[model samples]
Target chain A: MAAVQSDDPGLTPRSTMSWWFRREARIAPYLYISPFFLLFLVFGVFTVAFTAWVSLHDWHIFDTAAGGGTFVGLDNYARLLNDARFWRSATNTFSILLMSTIPQMLLALVLAELLNDRRLRGPHIFRSGLLIPNITSVVAITIVFQSLFGRHYGLINVALDFIGLDMVNWTSSRIGSHFAIATMVNWQWTGYNTLIFLAAMQSIPSDLIEAARVDGAGRIKRWWKITVPLLRPTILFATVLSVIGNFQLFAQPLLFAPGVGSMGGNDQQFLTILLYLYNMAFRQFQFGYASAIAWMLVLLTAVAALMVYAGVGYLNRRENRSALEVERMRERANARQEAGA
Target chain B: MTNVDAVKAQSAAGPTPGNERQAPTFKPNKRRFSWANNWHYLVLTVALFISVFPFYWMFVVGSNTNADVAQVPPRITPGPNFIENATNAMNAVPFLRSLLNTFIVAGTVTVSAVFFGTLAGFAFAKMQFRGNKALMAFVIATMMIPLQQLGLIPLYMLMDRFGWVGQLRAVIVPALVTGFAVFWMRQVIATSVHDELLEAGRVDGCATFGLFRHVVIPSVRSGAAVLGMFTFLFMWNDFLWPLVVLGGNQDAHTIQIALRNMSQTYYADYALVLAGTFMSLIPLIIVFVIFARQMIAGVMEGAVKG
Candidate 1:
C-alpha cells in the first residue's frame, strides 16, 4: 500500500527540498508577468524619459565622458522652430502622409467591398496574394522600387515610353520623388488596409443589405448608406493608424534617393521627419537635436490622432442624431395611425 | 389595364413604386447576371496583379544580366544569368552571415515573445493578481507609443553603456516581448481557454505554473504560433533599429543591412542588387506561402480587436 501510494503522482508527498514549489504557486502570476513590465520599464518608459532629458542638453553622439555637455533648456526646440530643413521635413512628412494614406484607404475600402461578395470565386487566393508585398522586407522593396523608378532604364519609364510619355526623372523632381515613394507605400499597405476593411465589412449584417434592397435601394446606394456608415469607426481607426505610420516613413525614401544619403533627395523632396531625425542623430551626431525631433514627432502624431478622434466623435454623434430622428418619425407615424383608428 | 384602374392602384399605394418593385428585387434569382459580380472579379484581378507584379519583376531582374535589365522596354522574361548574378551578389557582401544573423535575432525574439507573452497573457486572462487591470492597461497604452521614434536616442545610449552596441542581443533583447503580442495573446487566451479546465487541473494538484504549462499553453498554441510568426516577420524585416545599432559594423549586420550595403556597393548593378533583394525575400515568401491562411486570419483578428 505504501509503495502504491508512492507510485500515485497526486498522492506522493512533497520533499522538503521541493517546498519552494508550493510557495512559487502563490506568486506564479507575478513571476509570469514580470518580464514584460521589467522590459517595458527599461526599454519603453525609461527611454522616453531619457530622450526628454537628452533633448535639454547639448549632447553630442560620442560624448560619453562624464559631465561632457551643458544643458540649454528648450534651446533645441527653439532652434528647430527656426530651422528651414526641419520645416521642409515637416512639410514633406505631411505631404507623403496625405499622398500615401488617402488613396490607399479609399482603394482598400473599394477592394474590401468587392471582396466581401460571397459569390466571388477563390477570394482566399486574392487575399493571400494581396499580402505578398506587405510580407516583403522594406529593404527588398526599396531596392526593387529604386530599379523600377530608375531614370534611364526603369520599367516604369520604359512603360511610359511605350505609351508615348516622356521619361520623367523620378528621383530629381520633388513631386516625382514623392509620387514614387507614395507608390511604394501604397503598394505595400493597400492590401493590409483592405484586409482590415474586409474584416469590418464582414461583421456588418447581411440582413441590413437585404432590407435596403427590399426598400428599393440600388447596390451602390446600399453600400454608401448602410455599409459606409457602419464602417465609419473602422475607417477612422485605419486613418489614425495610417497617419501615425506615414509620419515615420523612412526606408523607402532613404533608398529612393539618387545617392545613399539621408537627405532623401538632392533637393530634400522626400525627407520625412523620422529620416530627418535619424540623419541628425546617427549621421550628424546631434543626439540632443535628434531627441528634440523625436519629441516633436510624438507631439505631431498625438495631435493628428486627436484631430481624427474628434472628427470621428462628431460624425458618430451626427449619425446617432439622424438615426434618432428616423426612429422618432416612425414612432409619430405609428401614433397617427392609432389616433385615426 | 384602364387609366381609371391604374389611378386607383397608384392612389392606394401612396405614390410609392417601392412596394410594387420590392418582391422582384428581393427574390433570389439563380440565373440573373450580376454586373457587381463581374466588377468584383475585375477589381480583385487588378489588385492581385498589382500586388504580385513587383515580385515577378524582381525575379525577372534578378535572373537577367545588367545589359539585359537595362534594355529599352526592359525584359519581361527571366534570363539565364540568375546563378551568375546570385554569385556576384554573394561576393559583394557577407550575405550568408547576415542571413544567419537575421535568423538569430528573429528566432530569439520570436521564441521570447511566444514564451514570455504566453506567460503574461495567461496571467492576465486567468489569474487575478494585484495591479492586473492597471498592468494590462499599461501594456495596451504602450502599444500606441512608437518604439523607434521615442526610444532610439536613449536606447543607443543604453547600448553604448552596456558595450552591446553592435551585438545581435541589442536588437533581440529589446524586442523580446512586444506590447501588441502580449495584448493579442491575452485576447486569444481569454476567449479560447476555459476556467473549468484550469479548475480541473487545480483539482488534480497541478500548481499555477503547471496549469499554465500543461493546460493554457497547449490550448493557446495556435495563438502563440500567430504571435511568433508576426514577431519573426517584423524582426526579419526590421531596418531602422538594426541600422542604427549595427551601423558600419558589417560583420554584425542583419540581412536588411546587408541588402542596403549591396545596393550601395553594387550601385547601377541592377542584376546584382535585384538578386540580393530576391534572396533576402525568399524566406519570408516561403513562410508566407505556408501560413497564408492563418496569417490572414491573424491579421484580421488583430485589426478587429486592435
Candidate 2:
C-alpha cells in the first residue's frame, strides 16, 4: 500500500520528496476545512464590517440619509449612550435574564440530581421529553404561549381564577409581560440546561462520593460541599449562554406583546437590545443608528462574558490554593511522624 | 480537572446512614438516601409532566373543533372534527404545494450537505493536508459567532442580487455547507473509516474520488443519514429568514410562515391553528420516532467524547 511504501522509505525517488511533500501533507487538513473559513471571511467578517460602516453614516433602509440627515461623527453612539430607550431595553434584557436564567439553572441542577439517582425509572423518557420544547418551532411555541397567556380567555387566567386569584394582564404591563416572556423561556430551556448539567454530573467519579459518604457526610452536606462546587464549569457555560440568548430575546417578546406590530411590549417594556436594533434597522429604517446599537450590544456581551470568565477563574484559583495548603499540612504531619520514629 | 474529579467522586460516594457507626446494627452498610436522592423521583416526575404537557395539549387541541376549542372551559375531549379541520387547513393554505416545496428544499439541502460535508470531513480526517490544524480550528470556532449576528442584511442582499430570494435555493444553498455538519461528519468518518480500506482501494487502481465513492461513502452512510435529518429539520422549521425573504410572496411561503400568518389573522381559531401546528410537527415526530435510537446515540456519543 501507499502507506506501507511511505513508511518503508525504500520507494521511488519521487515518493521520497521531502520539503514540499512534507509541507503539503501537513497542510492538507487545512485545505479540506478551507470552505468554512472562506465563507466566514466573506459572509461573517464582511457583514460585521458593513454594519459598522453603515453605522457611521446616516443610513436608511428606504430613503437616502441625504434626504434629512448628515454623517454626524460619534453622534449616534453619543445619543444611544444618553438614550432612555436604550437603557430601558438593557434593563428589560437583564430583568428577563435574572427572572429566567437563575431559576432555570437551579431547576436544572435539581432535575440533573434527580436524573442521576439510581432509583429513577425511565430516565431517558424524561430526558427526551425535556428536549421536546427545544426541538419545537419557535413560532409555534410563541403562538401557543400567546393564547395560554391571554388575559381574558387564556388557560393561564382560567387556572388563576380557579385558584381564586384575579386575572392578570400578562402581556400588557411591563412587569407582567416580562414574567410571561420569562416563563416561556424558562419552560422551553430548563430541560436543555438540565440535560447539560446531567452530562456534567454523570462524569463525576463514584469513588469520590463513596469517600465522602465514608467520611460520614450526609447527602445534603455532600451535595453542597461537592456537587455544586464541581458543576462550576458547566454552570458558567450555561450562564454565558443564558446571557447571550437573553440579549437576543426577540421572537417571544415580539409575538407575546399584545400590540399589533410592535417589537417590544407597551412602553417598550420587553424590547431587548437586539429587538430594538431589529426594529430600528428593519422597521423604523434607522439603519445607521441600529448598526451602532447592534455593535454596542456585541461589545457589551463580550465584556460581560469576559468578566464572568475572569471571576470564575479567580474563585477556582482560590479553591486550588486552599486545597494545596491542606496537602502541605498533611505532608508536614507525615514528615514530623517520620522524625519522631 | 483534578478538583472537578475530586468533587465528582465526593458526590458519587452517596450518603452513609447513621447505622454506619455500629457494624453489628441491622444491615448497617445499607446506603441512606440523600435529600437529593430522596427528591430525585419527585423532581423528575414534575419535570417530565411539565415538559410533555404542552405537546399533550397540542394533540388534544388538534382533535377538537374550532367552536369546541373556543368554548368557556376548553374541552379536553377529542372531537370528530379533526378531519374537517385538516381539510379546512388544506383549502385555506396551499398546504400541499408548501409541503412539496419544503420537501424539495429540505431534501436537496440534506443530500448536498451530507455528500459535500462527508467529502470535506473525510479529507480533513484521513487525508494528509496542509494547514489542517489551523483550518480545523477555524471551522470549529465558527459555531461561536452567531449567524444572525453577522450576515443578516448582506445575506439577504446576496440572495436578492442572485435572484434566489423566494427560491428554494435560498434555503438549500446556504444550508448545504453548515460548519456543524462538516464537523460532525469529520468526526464520524474519522472513527468509522479505516485508512487500510482506502489504501486497499487505491492499490486496486481506484482513484481518489473513486475510493471516496466506492469505499468512504458506504462506510459513513449512517452518519450522513443522521446529519441529513438534522439539516432537513433545521430548514423545515426555520422562520425568521424565510419570513424576511418570502415576505408576502404567497407562492413561495413556507409552512412555518403560513402557520404564523394563519395564527396572527385567525387568532380566535385555536383549533385551526393548533391543527396546523400539529400538521407541521408530524414530520419531525415521525422522523424522530423512526430514528430515535440513532439520533440519541449520535447525541450521547458527542457528549461523552467531546
Candidate 3:
C-alpha cells in the first residue's frame, strides 16, 4: 500500500525512513477504532453471550461451589413457562405497555401536528418545556409522582375531593397502580415522542399539504390524508422503540411501590418483567431464572418489533401499489388526450 | 430557528421552476380568526404547562414544611422552610457524597465518550480502513440491543469476578463509549469536515493523527459539545444499570440512588423527599436550559436520520 517515491533530489535518501511512517498511517485508523470494539466486546457481546450460557444452568448468585452450578438445560425456561408470577409480570408489562404506548403515540402525533404549524410563535419554548420531564431522572419522577398520587393528602386526591369524589388508594388496586405507573411513563415520554414526530412532520414536503388544501381538504383531513401516510416510516420506528422501552420498564414501578420490594404492590399488581427479573436475580439470588426471564423479554421485544415491522411493510406496499395505479391511469388519460389532439 | 429560516427560504424560493405558475394559486390560506388558527396554540400551551408543572410543584413542595404541604389547597408558592427541608434532605442520606460521586462518574464517562467517539467517528467517516463498513454497521446494530435487559446478570458476575461490584467504575467504564454517541459523531464528522481540509493538512506534512487533531476535531467541535452534554446528562440520569451495579452500596451511590434512598427513608416527609428530588434535578434543568437548542437539535437529528 506504499506510494511510489518521488524523484525529488532531497527525497531519495529519506524514502526508506518514510516507509515506517506510511505503514503507520495505513494502520492508524484501526488503532483509533479499537477502543470501542474492545469495550463493546468485553461489556456488551461477552455479557450477552455469557448470560445465555448461564441461563442453561442451575446457577445461583451465591452458589459458592468449587465449580459452576450443575448444567440443567431448559429447566429455567420450563420453570419460566409455568410460573404464575412470570405470567402475571408479563400481563402487567403488556397492560402497561398498551396503556402507555397507545395514548403516548396518539397524543404525541396530535401535539406534533400542532407544533408543526408555521404560524406558531416561540414554538421552541413549548418544545423545550416538553423535554424537561424527559431530562429529569426516573427516581425523581417516581418520587414526585408518588406524592402526587398519594391517597391521603395528594394534590390529585384533593382535586377529587373538590369534585365530591372519594379518594382512591392509588397504590392498592391493580388497575389503579398500573394506571399510576403508566401515567408517569406517559408523562415522561409523550413529549419526547412528540418531538420525534415533529421532526418527521417537519421533513414532510409542504407542497403536498398545500395541494390538499387547494383541493378543499380541511386541516384535519390534510393531516390524515397527506402527512400521516408520509410519516409511516417514522411512526413505525417510534413504535418499535416504544415497545422495546416499555417492555423493559423498571425504575418507575420499583420506586412507585417502594415498600413492596419488587412485588410492585401488595398483590404484585404492577410487577413488570424487568422488575421481576431484578427481584429474581438480586433479591432471590436466582441468577439462572433471571437470565431466563431476560431472554424471554428479549424474545418478546423481538416479536413485537417484527410484528410492527411486518404490519408497516404491508401497509406501505398496499399504498405504493395504489399510488402506482393512479399514476398509470393519469398517464393513460394524458396519452388519450395527446392522441385526440 | 434554523429550521424556521430553512422553511422561509424554501417558501421564498417558491416552487421549482416548472411549478412556479401554480404556486401562487395555491398559496396556503393566510392566517384567519378561526378555531383552526387558535386551537393548536391552545393545545401547545396546555402541553407545555403539563410538561413543566411537575417540576414547579416539586419546587413548591420542596420549599414548604410538612404542615404547609398538607394544607387543603397545597402551598402553591415557595414557602420559607427551604433551608430546613434541604438540611433534612442532606441529613437523610449522604446526599453531597452521592452528588460528587455522580459528577465524577458522569464527567469521566462524558470525557471518554467524547474523545473516543470523536476518534472512532472520524476514522469511520474519513478513513478507508479494512472492514470499515462492516464495523460501522456492527456499531449501529449494537444500538438496537438494549444493554441492561440482556447483559445485567452476566455483567454483574463479571464485575464480581473483577472485584468491581460496588465501585463507580462499574458504571463509568461500561458507559465510556456508546453506540449512539459514535453514530452521532460519525454523522456530524461526515457532514462537517470537508475532505479538502484533510488533504491540505496531509500536504503540509501533518501525520494522520495530527491531521485528525487539528482538522477533524476543530471542525466538529459543536457536534462533540452536543455529544458531551448528552453523555453527561445520560450518565447523570441513568438508573437501571447503576441501580443494579451499585446496589445498596451507600459509599458508591450516585445521585439517583441517594434520591431514592432519601425518599424511602423519609417516606412520610413529603418536604424532604421533594427537596432531595428537586436537588437531584437541579443540574439537569440548568444543563437543559443552557444547552436546550443543541440538545433539541441533537434529539431531532438522531430521530430523523437514525
Per-candidate TM vs. native? 0.90, 0.83, 0.90
Q: How much is the lDDT of residue B237 in candidate 2? A: 76
Candidate 1 residues B108-187, lDDT tens each?
Answer: 99999999998999999898877889989999999999978888999999998998988888999899888887898899
A1-341, model 3: which lDDT tens digit per residue?
23333223245456653664577677999998889999999999999998898899888887623446678999999999999998998899989888898899999988998889675789889989998798888888899999999888888999999899998888888888888888999999999999999999998866566655545567777677677877888889888988998888898888886688367777888889999999999889888888999999999989988988998889988799745643454466556658889
Candidate 1 local Cα displacement, residue B63, angstroms: 1.0
List residue ranges in candidate 1 displaced over 4 A. A1-25, A321-341, B1-37
Q: Give the distance in Å from residue B151's predicted Cα in candidate 1 to where it truly belongs.
A: 1.2
RMSD versus native structure for model 3: 6.3
Taken over the whole model, the C-alpha lDDT of each candidate is 0.84, 0.72, 0.84
Instruction: Give the TM-score comparing model 1 with the true structure, all chains together.
Output: 0.90
**Candidate 2 lDDT tens digits, A138-165:** 7778877887787766778888988899
The C-alpha stretches of model 2 lying farther than 4 A from their native spots are A1-31, A62-72, A321-341, B1-39, B65-73, B198-207, B304-306
Q: What is candidate 2's CA lDDT for residue B105?
A: 78
Docking verdict class for candidate 1 = medium
DockQ-derived CAPRI band for the predicted complex in model 2: acceptable
Return the lDDT, model 2, position A190: 89
**lDDT tens readout by residue for model 3, B86-170:** 8989989999999999999999999999999999998999998889999999999999997888999999988888888899999
2 or 3: which has the higher DockQ? Answer: 3
Interface RMSD per candidate (angstroms): 2.4, 3.7, 3.3
